[model samples]
Structures are given as C-alpha cells and as structure tokens.
Target: MADATHSTGMIRVWDPLVRIGHWVLVVAFATAYLTEGEPEWLHVWAGYAIAATVALRLLWGVIGPQRARFSDFVTGPGRAVAYLRDLIAGRAERHVGHSPAGGAMTVALLVTLGVTAFAGMGTLAAEEGEGPLAGIVAQIPETDGPRAYTGDHDEDEHGEHGEESAWKEVHEVAANLTLILILLHLGGVALASARHGENLARSMVTGDKRA
Candidate 1:
C-alpha cells in the first residue's frame, strides 16, 4: 500500500502505537532534560513517564507488528557498521522501517532513557527523600524510638547511606548521555534524509516512507 506523494511512493511502516510512543518519549525526555533541577514535580513526573514508556516499548518490541518488533530491524554490530559505511559512501538502502544503524540507535536511546529514569528516581529518593521509594530511602530518626518513615530527615543524618550525591551524579551523567544520543540520532536522520531523498523524521509522524 502506497501513500500519496508527489515524488515517491510511500508504504505503511511505522504503526500508530510506535509512532505515538516515539513522539511521547521525545517530548517527555525533552521536558525532563530542560526542567532538570528546577521543578522537582515536573522532573519526577517526566521521569516516571519515561519509565512507563520504556516499559511499553519493551513490551511492544516483544509482541508488536512486523516492523515494530526487535527481530525485524535489529541487526548484528557488523551489519550496523556496514550500514554506516554505506551511509557514509552514499550507497545506503532506503528501508521502510528503521535501517540497521537506526535500529541500533533506537535500542541505545531506549536503554539510556531507561537508565536515566531509574537514576533520576534513585536521586529523588536519596536527595529529597521523596519518591516511590521515599519511605525506605531516607527514614528520619525519632527522639526516643525507631526511625520514622518521614522524608523530612536531615541530609546529614543519613550521610553516605543515602548516597544522594552519588545517585544525583549518575542521573546527571545518564541525562547528558541521553542528550548526546539524541543529537547523534538527529544527525543520522538528516544524513539519511539527504542520502535517500526522504524526510526520515517526518516518516515517524506519518508512519510511512518512500517505498
């Protein structure tokens, strides 16, 4: 099935769920990245959304339609390298779904975003003592009894046990790496677009590409 296009034929490649999830992750990651350390609530919720998206994507990769499944586009590292070489040499094949290198980049981005979300959650629990793990992370000591589940404990009280700084650093590094991955992904899209004479980025929205 071809989508109407002036210059080239198009095919249904990306499914609606895949398209929606991809854009949602893009927005959620961008929101979290831009609002990091400013609005705690926004950051937390964004991270949560990212985590949720990753989960859905993982599930989709397992049981989704042909092009959306991991078995469909994922290739060996050798294949990915060959694809990159072809891309650089201007001989890359135009794929209806993701190309070999693009598939690898998708996996990398998903994993990195998942790690970023996890680290962000840990950081929130350790630093502010408030998150899904709040009750277990930064318990406050009572005057004459066992520690309370309140997250308002003094930072100094938990000390290294909280590992607040460490978790925060991990979160920051993961976020930065995710951003770098995003930049690389965009660059690859531009290069592929020019090489194949197709708007690869827009393909995600319409779920079709030159066929």
Candidate 2:
C-alpha cells in the first residue's frame, strides 16, 4: 500500500505492525534481560515473546509495506561500510526509510536476539527438563551407575549436565552480544538523528519522516 502523506509533510513509513512489534520487542528483551531468569515464568515468557516477534518481523520484512521490506534497504556489507564512511564524514544521503547501516544493524539485532532466545530455551530444556526442546534435550540416557540410582550426583550421572552448561554458555554469550548490539544501535540512531536533523526514534513511533 502507498504511504499516506499529509500537508504537514509527514508520511507513514513504518506500518502499525512494524511499530508495535518494535516496541514489543524492546519491552520483551528488556524484561528478559533484566530479570536474569528470576521469576522463571516471566523470563521464559518474555523470551518466547522476543522469539515470536522476531519471527513475525522476518516474515514482514519479506511481504510488508514498501519501507518495511528488506529489499528496500538491505544493501550488502560494502554499501553499509560505504554509508558508515559517508556518515562519519557528515555527507551521508538522507533516506526516508532505513539506510544501509541501519539495515545491517536491524538484521544483526534480529539474528542475535533470535539466538539468545533459542539458546535460552535450549538451556532450560537441558537443565530443567522444561521448555519446547525438553523432549529432545532431556532424552539423554542416564549412566548405569550407583550415583545415577542413588541421585547422589545426578548432575554428573550423564552428559546432560555438560550439555546444559554448553547451552547456558551459548545463551549468556548471545545475550551479551545482543546487549552490545543494542548499545551500538542506539548510538547509531542518535548519531543519524543528529546528522540528519530528525528524531529517528520518534519516527519509529509516529511512522513518519521528512517526505
């Protein structure tokens, strides 16, 4: 659909789905990260929300509105690097939609968040015999030993503990990476807004930019 433009020169860039999903993801990630897995139910549900939102966003990027489509802004790394160079020089071209660097950051955040969420599920499954992967991950055979029968050292009875630890490490690393990417994303947004004389964050909320 064509974006609606008004006399005030503002135009709809992000669709309602895009805008809502963006905020939902922001809240969900913050909830999951800050809780640090305490109040287990909340943390798990928040991670699930992040996963679902990212999945929907990926689909939307394929078939959404003009500005939301990946084809509109997902230029390659070379273009992103070139845009960054131009941006640093204060000579970057203005884009009503996402710039190359912005597009790259979007993709990176999506992938990193997805990894974090799924790795958390894997950790949950392997560690607690819970979550979606529980059936698969919890099926590891217990060792035929006195410790296994006595439950004296259940964690060391099989490879499950090691598997759980590995998944936990992956989840933690991915979550940390997501945090770093988020900081970089915010910095880029602030810099781009200042350089272009526009509020990029407000544009995401109002779904408008100079047109």
Candidate 3:
C-alpha cells in the first residue's frame, strides 16, 4: 500500500527553502534557549542566527513557491478555531500543506520568536553595553562615591541599572513565552499526525507525505 501510494505522482508541497528554514530555526532556537545567559557569546550569536533565519523566512513567505507562500496557508482566526474544533472531534480534513490551525501556529511561532530574539538584543545592549542597540541604551554612569548614598548621584546610578534590569526581564519573558509556544506546536503536530494517519514530523524531514 505504501509503495502504491508512492507510485502515483505526489506533489512537492514544502519547498527546499521552507524545509531548510524550518530546521535551521529549530536548531538556532534550541541553541539560544538552552544556553540562556551563561556563555554569553554562544547565546548572543545563536540569537543572531535565529534573527537572520527568521528574516529570510519572512522574505520567502512573500516570494516562495505556491505552497510556501503565506497566502497559500494563512487563514482567518475563525477558520483556525473551526479547524481546531473539528480536530478535537476527530473529523478534521487532511491538508496537503498547513491546515488552518497549523497555519495559525506557524504565524504565531514566527512572530513570537522574532520578538524574543529582538528583545534579547535589547537586553544585551542595555545590560552588557553591547549588541545592536548599544549606542542608544547609553552606558550606565560610573560611581566613585563611598558606601554611603549621595543625593541624585545614587538615583542616577540606580536608575540606569534599573533600566537594564527592565530590558532583561522583558527578554526573559519573551523567551519563556516562545518556549510555551513551542510546546503547544509539538502537541498540535502530534495530534494532527494521529488524526490524519500520517507521520507529519517525518514528512517535514523528507518533504513528502502519503499524497
């Protein structure tokens, strides 16, 4: 049956650029998330790589193949909700490319990951006096005062540090949110695979399904 299915000409749904972008983003995101703050260079460079990957993906979404374009898959939120409802009821239709819910997840993941990476850049600039925003973040004022407090000098010093802390917190929150989205994405893939009776994850690797 498997051979017979393959005998009929199958459509090439996922283009090479799409597949490559997907896997590279997976690796880049993993590297950035796992390293976190320590080994600052590794985390920072990983984030940069992710940013580049996403930029290319955004471009591809505009000019890629028929199945790769955002217009090919992206649908309204109402459609995504209806798809999810059918999915839960075990009556969802198999999509040659991305289903409505999957399309929604894809958009959400791309936007959130981009936000997370950009937030990291801001945090790096503010806290480490480095990254793309460094010039704009203004270096924290140096303090030569005694252990005791000075009037506005102390406020100025602490205020700079506080701004850095705020950026760091925003970065952390964005990263954590990305992590949650990833988990939800995996769950959606598993459910879709089971319902469709096809190995969706393996299809991503081979860029071919039972079509």
Candidate 4:
C-alpha cells in the first residue's frame, strides 16, 4: 500500500496502521488521563496501551507508506514557525500529507506522550515495585504496619524518595503538557480545515484527501 493512490480524485495519505494508531493513542490517553490513576488496573493498562501505540507509530514513521514517513513531513522548527505564521495570515498552502506545523505537532505529541507514559511506569515501579522498571528504580520498602515517622533516613533512602517524587512530577508535568499540545493541535486542524474548505478530521477517518 506504499504507492496506493486512487483515481477518483482522492489520495490515500494515511495508511491503516497510522489511522489506527492515531485513534488508539487518543482513546488510551483519554482513559489514562480521565481516570487520574484511580482504579489502578485500568490506568496502568491504558498507559501501557499508549506506550505501545507510540512505539509502533514511531516504527511505522520509519518504514510505512511515503506519506507516513517522517521524511515526508517532518521539518525544522523555523519552517514550522513560518507555516504557523502563514496559517494565521490565511495564506497557508494545503498539504496532501501534513503541513510543517502539523508535522511539528505530531513529533511533539509523540515525544510528550512517551515521556508521560514512561514516567508513570517509573512512578509505579518506585511506589509499588511493579512495572518494567521494577528493581531498576529503587522500590520503596514495604511495611506491615503503619510506621512511625522518625526524622531518620539513610542517604540512600532519601535518594530513593527523591527519585520517586521526581518521577511523579515528570509524569504530571508531561501529561499536562500533552493536554496543552492536544488543544493546540485541534485548534490548528480546525483553522486549517476552515482555511482550506475541507474537513481535515474527516480525511483522517477516511485516510484520503482531494488529489
């Protein structure tokens, strides 16, 4: 399907893998975020789904169809900034694949989501001695009873506590950043759709755009 384009005036810009991965990320991220770490099973699984989807998407970006390849759309930050400027001026060009700004957003989303998911895993490992990072990230000591808070802690214990706190902070900050990016991405899509007189979101669903 690498060279697949239609003769009905529609071009197949996104392949099935890309489309599925995109939506999977959307649903998984929403589930993980909305659950807010409650119902631990659901949250952990949702996060795992997100991480897996992102890894697959990154692989696809390297070996998928032409339009799906990072080479086809990924551009420098300056280009993305210029594209945004043009978009705001209502003079941006329509792209069969992804515009410079859209490409940049795609990279940003993937990286941020990866960080958020992995950081959550680290937090889990440190707090519960679970996840892939278990035994790698220092696990908090388990206690059978409520322990008294003595202001005494070894340097190693203090370091472990700091690591756990850092992981939690990273997870929270990255998750919040992903939300901000998602809002910006949606706004960009809306603006581009209006400017181009096309349903960009619909194109993603159908995996095609006007040729």
Candidate 5:
C-alpha cells in the first residue's frame, strides 16, 4: 500500500457542524458589539445567539470528528513549550487540524466567552430589576467587584453592576479581547494556508477539500 498525497493542502479540517458553530459565534459577537446601544434589540438577539452557539460548540467539542474534538489538539504546558520551540526553528510539523497553541487559544477563548455571555445576561436581568438571581445577588459584597453570582443586582453588592455603565464597560472589555483572539486566529489560518497551500477558510465553508 502507498500513502496518499493531497493535490494541495486541501485535506478536510473542520466538519460542517464545526464550521456552522464558528460562523454563528462570529456573527453573533459582531452583531452584539455593533448594536449595543442605538439598536439594542438586535444587540440582545446577538448575545442570545452567541450563547446558543457556545452551547452547540460545547456539544461538538465532545463528540465531533477527530480534528474537531478537543482531544485532538489540546496539549499541556510541556507540549506547548515544545510546539513553540519548533515554530521558532521554522521546523514545526504542519498539523491537518489546529496546532497545539491554537488549541489552547481556542479553549481559552471559549471559556472566556462563555463566562462573558452568562455574566452579561445576569447584568441585563439586573438592569431590568428582574435578574434570574436578582433576589439572591442583593446579598453580595459591594466593596470589591462583581461577585461570582450573587445576583443582588445592587450596585454595592460586592459584584453587582448597580448601573448600566459598569455593565457596558465589562461587556466592551470582553468584546475587545474576543476581537483580538479572532484576529489572531485568522492570522494563524492565513499563515497555515500559505505554508501548506491550503484554503483553510474555504474548507470551513463547503466542508470539503481535496481530502
């Protein structure tokens, strides 16, 4: 038997589900950010969409295709250190899926976004004076900052937003961090596509490549 050779770096990477979740999250994030105030209704929809996309992704990370699954790429610090060394030497092996560093980044981004989404929701509820945990949160300490989930929705509650301005600031910070991660992710894709002669972005769309 002989090994197979791809015409280009067109071997499939992301599955259909993975691609859908990726785009859904992207659009949701962008829409949420763009329509934050003037068109608040659209912004709220975007936030909900982002949260839903995260839920879908959580499922996919567990049972999706080999490459799409979290186990395929996530590595510990030791492996990450080695992967970095290889990259610096320009001798890094090209992975058909996400590189180890990319995997860590993905996980970080996912967890952060999930937290932001949930927290944002709480803030919104509090703003409406009917937060899910609104009654309970009133008891949190207000001296420090937003409590883990006190839900008092009171300003002085250790972690309550107490005001819309505070919520907006936190939301913006998370959004900015997300934007940076997205840019980094795209840059890495561009680099990989060029190095491997792959249309990484295109594969995410049609869910098919030379492979």
Candidate 6:
C-alpha cells in the first residue's frame, strides 16, 4: 500500500536563526519569570536575554530563510479572518510552515510579549532596581502621565522612587499575563499539531520535518 502524501524528497524546513531564536526566546522568558523582581542580578540577566531574543528575531525576520520572514507568513488581517472562518467550518488549510492563524498568533505573541517586556523593564529600571537601563531613563516623571503602572519610593538607593505603590503593581500584572500567553501558545501548538499531523515542537528543535 502506498501512502497518499508520501514523497521521498523532503525539503529543508527551518533556518538556523529561526530555530535558535525560538528556543532562546522560550528559555529567556522562563528565566525572566522565575527571577521576576526577586534576585536583582538574575532578573536583569533574564531581561537582557529576552531583549536579545527579540532583537535577534527582528533581524532574522528581515533576512532569514524563505519560510521564516514576516512577509512569508504574516498575511493580511482579512486573510486571517477568512482562515478562522475556515476553521469554524472544519476546513482549515494546513501549511508547511505557519498557518494563517498561527502566523498571526506568532506576531501577536511577539508584540504583546515585547510590550510586556518593555513595560516590565521600564518599571524595574525606573523604581528600586539596578538594571543596565536604569540610569538612562532616570528622569522620566512617570506620574506626569497616566499609566497603568505605579512605581515604588522606598528612599532606598536601589532606584526606588521614594516605597509607594506604582510600577511594581504593573510589573506583577504584566508578568502574570505573559505567563498566560505562553500557556495559550503551548496549547494552541499542541492542538494544531494533533489535528494537522505535524510535530511542531520537534520542528522547532530539529529545524526539519516530514515534509
């Protein structure tokens, strides 16, 4: 018996940078969460790692392999909507790379994670922390503008504005939300893989697949 989709020539799938960036982002995010606002040095390192991962992904998105570019998968919102409609009809198309919804999810995750990271870093550096960026933005009057975040003022030399409630609250909320996103991402990947006959986790790890 011959398989319907069998093909001897499996093509190269993932680029080196894409694979590295994906895993690096995962590890960096985990490290950041584990060390959030506690051990100053570890937390700062985690932030740096995540920032690096984001920067690397941005660069790779510009010059990476064929299937790794933003243009390759980040289709229009209308297309994404259409794809969702297909999913509802149980007729969603499976892509060798990221499907429409998955691609959009990737972009959303990157953006929201970036925002959460930026807010987290901003809050940490502004208040009672000694991050590398702490001294640079030491002059922004956070109270001058309406922000969801609030800073601390402990009169402590750790960058605390003076031990009031401010950025700390913001950081906590954002971190928790980021964790939720990560969980959702995992579940989505699992569901997609199970339904579509793909091993996405292995694809990211080995940079290849049974294509």
Task: Give me the candidate number with maximum TM-score.
Answer: 2
Worst 10 contiguous positions by lDDT, candidate 2: 143-152
In order, candidate lDDTs are 0.81, 0.86, 0.78, 0.85, 0.69, 0.69
TM-score of 6: 0.77
When summed lDDT is taken over every stretch of 10 residues in candidate 5, the lowest stretch is 142-151
Question: Residue by residue across 1-211, what tens digits does model 1's lDDT show?
Answer: 2333435466778889999999989999989999865676787898999999999999999998888899988999999999999999999887877899999999999999999998787667665566775565555342122232233444556473433255667888989999999999999999999998889888889888766
Winner on TM-score between 1 and 2 is 2
lDDT of 5: 0.69
As for candidate 4, its clashing pairs are none
Clashes of each: 0, 0, 0, 0, 14, 12
Give me the runs in candidate 1 sitting further than 4 Å from their true place: 1-8, 135-164
| Candidate topping lDDT | 2
Steric clash count of candidate 2 = 0
Predicted candidate 2 versus true structure: per-residue lDDT over 162-188, tens digit per residue:
232567789999999999999999999
How close is every model to the real structure, measured as TM-score?
0.83, 0.88, 0.83, 0.86, 0.74, 0.77
Count backbone overlaps in model 4. 0
Give residue 49's lDDT in candidate 3 (0 to 100): 85
In model 3, the worst 10-residue window by lDDT is 143-152
Deviation (Å) of 50 in candidate 5? 0.8
lDDT of 4 by residue, 86-168 (tens): 99999988888899999999999999999999998887776666788776675344422222222243246557532235677
lDDT of 6 by residue, 1-211 (tens): 1212336544456777888888887887788788654676676677677777777787787787768788788988888788767765667787777778778888876876676667667666665444555665465665433233232323558755554435556666767777887786787778777767778898888766665
* TM accuracy, model 4: 0.86
**Ranking of all predicted structures according to lDDT, beginning with the best and ending with the worst:** 2, 4, 1, 3, 6, 5
